[model samples]
Target chain A: MNTPFSPERAAELGDAERRGSAAQLAATSGLPDTSSEAWRYSPVSDLNLDELRVVTGAPPAPPDAPQYVTEAIDSLQAAATVSVIDGFVVAVELADGWVAKGLSVESAAVKLAEPEEGPNLFDHLHAAFAPDGLVIKVPAEVEITDPIVIRSHLSEGAAGFTALKVHASAGSRVTVFEYQSSESGGLVVPMTQFHVEQAAKVNHVVIQDLATDSWQVGRVTSRVEEHATLSSAMIAFGGKYARIRTDSDLAGRGATGELVGAYFCDGDQIIDYRTFQQHIAPDTLSDLLFKGTVDDESGSVYTGMIHIHPDGAGSNAFQTNRNIKLGDEAWAWSVPNLEIENNEVRCSHASTVSPVDPDQRFYLHSRGVPPAVADRLIVAGFFEEALRRVSIPAAAQIARTLIAEKLDVRLEQP
Target chain B: MSELIVDQLAVKVGGSQILSGVSLTVPGGEVHAVMGPNGAGKSTLSNAIMGRSGYEVTGGTITMDGQDMLALDTFERAQAGLFYVMQAPTEVPGVSMFDMLTASLSAQGTASTDLAATLSAEAAAIGFDVALLERSLNVDLSGGEKKRSETIQMSVLAPKVAIIDELDSGLDVDGLRTVAQRVEKLTNDGLGVLVITHFPRLLHELNADRVHVLAQGKIVTSGGPELAIELEQTGYGAYVEEETPEPKSGGLDDLFSM
Candidate 1:
């Protein structure tokens, strides 16, 4: 079958036999058209797959962590840290009795988990082109006090593919924070998965600050078992057209999950999100909130779905999406949905797309605050609600700093 | 110190005259009260002097310290030491009192040192919760809390003239005393006071130097603080009888025709 990719491009992707077969399969299936519901409002046609030259094979030598990655680790109190470049795990440091796997040269490669429903065109493309990645698998009953910091700082390769999976054992507690950046986040498809065993707890935070002219199409999927809990937060500040699709399953009784996101876009960027919360067991609960701001002719889209089956009786589910448009041309689309087939359940959803409250602006002015400064404060304050819901302590502060930097470029002028 | 002078102020809101030839002076280091019954154009005078939108000054002159105040924006007017504590201050969610006060002072290049300490001291003086100073600005606060909170803000700015509307409406006896005492301290330090209220209890606490009766879109009379006591005894019956009927309202038909 003729494909957008060259056969040699597959070899450039990886020497792994698994990758070669996956690439061949993707060569036949090709990318998804906009007909698919998931591809709606997405810039799928703009993806020039053959243009990205990803470094997928083994490195020439043991690579060293870049200054940015090393400095970020030093500034953070990390129980373990892993740095990856162009899909290769280059550095790993474990401290204070925390054990993880797939961080060494012999065992760096991890088998990608295919979605049960089937792999989409992007998933197959990711499997075909991805290289050896750092997979942090935690042992049972071990409680980690600090975050397992994962830095995917890929700038050399024009684009790359990375897949990270977290498998938390029963009765264990762990926190993971992932930071992704590139000259742009590049035209990469990064995938993440989480499996929370019975009675375990997991907290995850993801921050994306790609440069202009970048495209990041990513997926994060998780399953929570009996009595376990999973909480996740995502913060986005850059990317020309970035999209993340997340799916969480409450598969066991008494399981719980919470999802939060804080995103800011400026200068022709479009940050999109589509999420699903599946309640499959009785007495399960799931809550989700995503808030963002669009400025300087930029736009954002948030579409969420919640499903409660017959077994999901006596469950609770909630979803809320709020956005502030700071520029005259800025825009947002917020859609929240719910599908229930059960009788005893509590579910609600709310969404808003508004400019800053004029009364709030006037109140600040009444206090002698300048109009420009009052605007900056209100925009910064809009993120406090979503940021406080993040379990990771450092996520809020880091997001605040990045937001302030973005505000400075638009505000600080004569 | 100089006085805030409103001369022959005739203002219209939405093409209806609310204040007609109303004039008063709030000199620094003295308290002046504007008392009247409801719909007597008291708040309109305050809103117009502060240059709020929708309050059009059809014919008037408002000057402060010999500077033409109408040429300045509302925030610029505020930056130049004009402070007004409104009747019901609106809530701004997610913006902390610290953020507002810090930016308020810093925007003016004023000394914002020890802002939290200053807020705590001022809030405690008005019997307000100090912890609320760290929370969002007036969000979820009770009516009395908002009044006291505005008083604290008044103390923080220490403006030359403070135009307070309904200062005693939302306060209990104790709350009113403490809030009045805080403002009294600032007034003693040469801060001019323009307290607008229908009740005379706050005027007694404030100890006004001048009292003006505003009715029929104008000030009908002016006297010493003793005038407030006299109005309290006699009520606004005589002044309200001089109703300059609104031309737009054809009295009986305007109320029941619709």
Candidate 2:
């Protein structure tokens, strides 16, 4: 373990109690390189762990700075604006109608000694490393028109953790937009926990366009209540190594979850994604579609699964992963798994990993588009489906523009 | 002067020759029909002319208005006044027909593609519902609707040469009449029409100037409309292989060689 760290550096763990707790958390969280199912495709040990540092100071303020403005960010229906700097909640603006209670977002030193839920090791990690995060609570029967916007900024050499807890009461509806960016170069680890009450609805949007030299790790878990709906989107277009895992549980009858994602990776960028749609109640519906494109020597991995419990009869689920590699040097791997413990359920998964069709490109080129332009056109067309699902027009166009840049082409509007 | 000339052209797919030394010329203002049974390479001929990437050009030359068509890519060929209404047009999801058509036109460097203005006029001319153009390009469109959308595309692009591939498929009598009317209008506007089909019903309605019967990848017979009538009545028996085994004889050998 000391191979990469000197004796003095290893002593940074401080007291025996803190070292014991860190070791215990690392061990029991099943994050080991050997036995964790989730880590099978990705090896964290290969990340040069010792080289990663916790936040020492504020990240460099970007020129023309932060990816989103307060106005555009707050435009999401009924959503307020919350900005996090170096793992601390710097600014928070709640909506006018919603009254918040019993939820406090302060420095981790002011919170409990340990995470209330042991399974959420990142919560404890956030409590330890993060200066602050946020806690949002919605009481019963309240409906919000705007989506809350949360922007997390990371600068070079800045390693920070933030934990977001969103609890929606029965019949409450809310939408949250999470934007993550890295200024200069750095790494960020973010974990989010969502609790949806009976008949509630939650729509979440995650936008990641980090600096080229940054790395991002994000995990999201949701619990769906009876007759509730959770629609989530993860759009990743930049960063060197961006890994996202979204796990959802439909634990009550008539629950539905729709997950859509679109990513564009180029150069030596590596994008890893893992998702799970668990059915624990009858008549639940979960659909996931993620489309991506890889150019140059970029690599992408998508491993997804839909698990149905025995009591979860009459459930219907669908998962599709489609990607187009613009160059022979680019690579993509997709694996879709279906685990069924019930007899009367309907679930299907399909994945297509192929380069752009020569015929399709020729067809476009025959119309006078150059070969490179034709490739970009078809690739954009390939991603239009997943991108179209996004509600904001500017965000959609920005996503497509980023994709064009990733493919080394300009977005030529007709 | 925008003419298409195919001189002794040969095309192949997957190592099998489909069009062999086929020579035909389509002036800027005429309707030509290529009638044949299944496997006659009628569709293959149109696909080859469009420079569809999968096919190989084995021999001969294709020229459009004195420019070498074979030297151009599919899009370039399309830009040079050639439009192939695919037999099965790809259903591109999330791309609206208006956007796709206008983008295609702009890509080809067309100057008259104000989508909203053009769409309204074309929709009125074709009696197409204006709302339909806003939907995803060909996605969820019915067979007849897809054909109509292709026709709408033709109307918008207004290319010099328009190749219709089996426009009769999935169309009822009324739809066929509508398509024929549009094709007649296009032809009257001086656009060259190359209609590839097995059935001559649409050709007869549109009054083809020349009828070529394609057999085994080449035009075996070229004549007036009478040839289509003849084949429609005779059922391609002369070109098709005999179903029943004939005893070995010179008569059978002559019949075998078409």
Candidate 3:
């Protein structure tokens, strides 16, 4: 199979070998099929990667910058922006403070070392081109209020890879907002790894808005230290095939983790998400809630697990996934699992998959709210729990609008 | 000026007729007590009046304030001053009482009034914590607490007509007195009150203007408070005594009547 070279991997090699190596990685990595757990809901075999080439289209001209990002990024004066053009990181915007601390940003193709078992898929992503990869490390006690923005723009016929690594020191508060936007015919693969030291806090908000013909596969992992707090929120809309896999570990005593995901699917779109909240130490806590609604033949899948190890005594954890079936054909599959070996731990998991209640519809319709408006109200109420918990105000507002638009329903501002 | 008039109402549930030829009326600013033994179509009549989704009203006209109450949905009926405090309130897991009240109030198209402050003052008068106002709506609530919470909702929403079913069944003496006082306030404010109860204690406190005895889905008798005292003494035997001739097959039927 013939494939294109990744821009990131080419940076580590002479121009000639970089394309060869990237082509090899792309050729060896097949499109995901039904056999993989992550690809269960979205069948990618039909994507036909063999014929797709690396996108070479120019990035879309920046629109009026979003006010939310402008304010949130400005607050993090010490952070930098790693901008991606057609899945390739074309430029890195670094806060002068970070460049002074020996921070470096470049594209490199990392290879997976041979292990006892076969190489993991994520390592393959690392081994391929990382044209938009950024390596970040902060000193101890360097608190930053502003957020670092990693913005990705996918132009026409663009396909690329982007990866990020954020390492935070003890007692530091760092916020990162990753924006994935595309209006092109291509695929964007993004994988991020976060490291939080003891007594540190890291907040992440991932916003995905790709073109209707685009595909996005995002994977994020957070390794949390003792007494560390990690809050993550993923907001996604408008992708032909979008799936996000998030894994976090509360490895230290008194560590806390918060995971929230809100998505809207419309126009035969498919969005699937999987999250893992692991409690590995005593006195640790984790909360997970992923809520979404599907309309217009759209579908969503949410599978979450909270694993409490035997050593995780006094661990308190909960996982909830709820979805509203808007379209007669729209579907959602939610599987919540709890594995607990400790006797003193408290854990519960619940999942509900049902159409809007007839009674609730009648209740709203009786109030002069038209049937369509009534349905929107119920769907909005369905996701209100997650929307209220979205830490970013602008993100929350956009989520509300996206939900309304996906349903093709309009709401008078309350 | 306001009245809930049900004319010859017939209702069916699960393919069985539970209420037939049932006709009753509750006028404005009055407390009407409907007393019947279990399975006598008491709750079915109330549910039919409020236009519950499943109950099939085979034949009836329910008019409130000379308007077609039967045409309204449950919440619309409520918005038009009709309230149904269920014998067993539905459990809303994530909805808080405070939020439900505000939403309901807004749905009723009420504007610019402080329901929370009014409810707080009422709760203080009833010796309940203002904090109880923060609890989830009927979630993790005790039977008595659920009843009290419904009572608070009625007080705060201030519907035009309140239909309270078995409000005293599960309450302690103190809780019962508190609800009775709330009902009195509603009636004082000119809202029609229809309280359904099998016992005389609730009516004794309510001082219902009309006492209707329902037997076999019909109002067999209607009178003042004395009617309750007479039914209590005669054990519904007087009505049967004058009606039943030859008591050979009067086993379950007689027990049900009593």
Top candidate, metric DockQ: 1
**CAPRI classification of candidate 2:** acceptable
C-alpha RMSD in Å of predicted model 1 compared with the true structure: 4.7
Q: Write the per-residue lDDT of candidate 3 for residues B208-233, one digit (tens) a residue.
A: 99988777767888899888777665
Candidate 1 segments whose C-alpha is farther than 4 A from its true place = A1-4, A12-18, A28-32, A58-75, A100-118, B10-17, B39-41, B230-258
lDDT of 1 at A280: 97
Q: What is the C-alpha lDDT of each candidate?
A: 0.81, 0.73, 0.71
* Chain B only, TM-score of each candidate: 0.92, 0.90, 0.88
Residue-by-residue lDDT tens digits, candidate 2, A327-349: 57988889899999997888989
TM-score of 1: 0.90
Better of 1 and 2 by TM-score: 1
DockQ of 1: 0.59
Q: Which whole-number lDDT from 0 to 100 does residue B123 have in model 2?
A: 72
Kindly list the per-residue Cα lDDT of model 1 for residues A294-372, writing each as its tens digit.
9988989899989998899999999999999988999998989999989799999999999988877777777788888
Query: Mind giving the per-residue lDDT tens digits that candidate 3 earns over A1-414?
Result: 344445443444344364545446655766655786656766566565544455433345544335655554455453667676655566767767755654444544432223222444334443454453566666677776656677777665555666677777898877777777775667777777788999998888887878777877767778789999888888888688887777888899989999888888877788889888789999998988888777768889898878898899999998888887767888888988888888899887888878877766554433333445556656766776787777666566666666666665434323
DockQ of 2: 0.41
Q: State residue A124's C-alpha deviation in candidate 2, in Å.
A: 7.2
Best by TM-score: 1
